[model samples]
Target: MSYKGPEPRRYPTAPWGAGDSATAVESGKLPAIRPIWDVHIRDTIVCLGGDGFYYMTGTTGDNCWAFNDGVELWRSRDLKTWGYLGLVWSIDRDGTWEKNWTARAGVPFRALWAPEIHFIGGNYYICHCISGVGIGVLRSTTQRPEGPYAHVLSDQPIKGGIDSTLFEDDDGKVYLSWGAGQRIREIKPDFSDFAGDWQDLAFDDSGIDPKAKKNGQPLRRVGFEGATFFKANGKYYAGACNKDEGRYSFWFASSDKLLGPYAGRHEGPPGGGGGNLFRDKAGRWWQTFFGNDDQMPFREKPGLIAVEFDAAGHVVASADQPFKPFA
Candidate 1:
């Protein structure tokens, strides 16, 4: 049978197998490939905190494709054990314009999609999108991840795009890109508003994906959604998601400049799409994972896959990958 929507949220009586033990993870006895927590989450994003912890947030709620609450977060010291931070931001209490409901295909849909938490300029900020509406950013007043958060762009969204992501360059300049890297703009140093107008980004080479077509022609963009940006090894990388042979794939393209005429896109990690990439406290590269396709080992649960740059600076699955996807 074909898939419908996400499985209805069911509260577990007791915690299920929460991956390997913390000792195993710390001692390097196990590879970090399993779901960190058993919960229904999509577009999982993890960022290293100033206090030496990893904070994770994603598209969360009972029915995210329809309606639900605001952003929920989880904290981890070792990446093996996660502590729930509860609903840090709520649409009902904290949202100003974000509380407005928007309809999707004749259905009233209002849920936070892909809320990314980042520690930038000595403070914590979250950029999120509301389906059918647009994207908005929030800042932690107390400089904490579990924020008593407030909207940076008051009473309106920053832009009309989904899967909004923030990338902080080495010089501490922050850029916001969304909708699979279709548009990007620089955010002000104070997180007030866009410092510059949106620039369109595209790849030089068109990727082959049978499912991604526009007016009977193949789409040339990286992927249809889930834009991620990061600078690695002195090169800027823009990543997004696409379906290849029924499996969700993370595709990336690189360029010397931020606003790219990026090189041709290539697949990064198979079955690892709709997520972002980040380095841990130890400076090791990793990609956030929440399986979105049947080829994955599991579905709709947060997972992590170790990644490394190849000789050509392409992100690929690391040699220590534990939970390999099905062939």
Candidate 2:
């Protein structure tokens, strides 16, 4: 666990017996997400896996901030010291994903873009993506991870869907990766459908490379499209997000199972054009994407960077070590 870069004194403290609501970490710093919503924010983040920590949902503000990103900053059993569980679900007319499918699609889907909060089988789904439709799944019947959820797929229409992502795997199966820009699909386990056909895995236009040409042209296929898949050691990684060079980049590919012949994939600029990949369980790798808030100064601010991967995985971003959510 020693790639050592920004020690900041290895933040995270509370050990001794841990509790007082335990929370520590600020060494070389690197953990600051601030903004928990007050208005105007979109597609920020949506990580989920609770009971042990990690729940970052998005789309905050408007319609009385319906679920306002469901705001709940931090919590961790071991993702490092994070202890902030504030806002938990809202927008109700009777619940059921806000009174039956965003009020019968009459508008006000509020905060439902990439919500993803899965616990599966035993039940706890929450896969979202709605502003115009495409993917949805919100069942939590009860076992609460802060949910009043229960949308059971929300009717239909998922061809080139939104940014949804849900995976179960340990053998129970259940997969559902979305599509927005680069297209990907694999949902079927009664999650209501979609599981065969729709796998464009980016790098298209015939995956150009006219001799690595730059200004001379050739090398098009740019489209990472927010894909997601995970598993370590046993391998199966697939992380994406490439906006065709307009500035959102991150990429990854690997396989050993879960459909993919992906092996040793590559992209441009030491891997920014690649899409983000943040693996942790000790393998220690980080890669978050998105840049250009159009010269900051408050232009809606959108710039996140965290790079560091090497062990042959290439990307070694100047030894990045900022995201220390808790040592």
Best by TM-score: 1
- Writing each residue's lDDT as its tens digit, candidate 1 over 89-183 gives 98877887777766566555577898999999878999898887898889999999988998885558876779888889988888888887877
* Cα TM-score per model: 0.85, 0.29
Error of 2 at 259 (Å): 2.4
lDDT of each: 0.77, 0.44
Write out the backbone clash pairs for model 1: none
Which segments of model 2 are wrong by more than 4 Å? 1-58, 62-110, 115-128, 131-155, 159-236, 239-303, 312-327
For model 2, residues 1-327, the per-residue Cα lDDT tens digits are: 111122222223212211221111122212232222222333334333545454444443433123233423334454434454644554343334333334323433333444545666655666555544456666656756665665664444343356676666677776666642344556667666656766654332233344434676633223335556666566665665554323344445555765655555444222132223444444465443222222111111112334454575534443343532232
Model 1 score (lDDT): 0.77
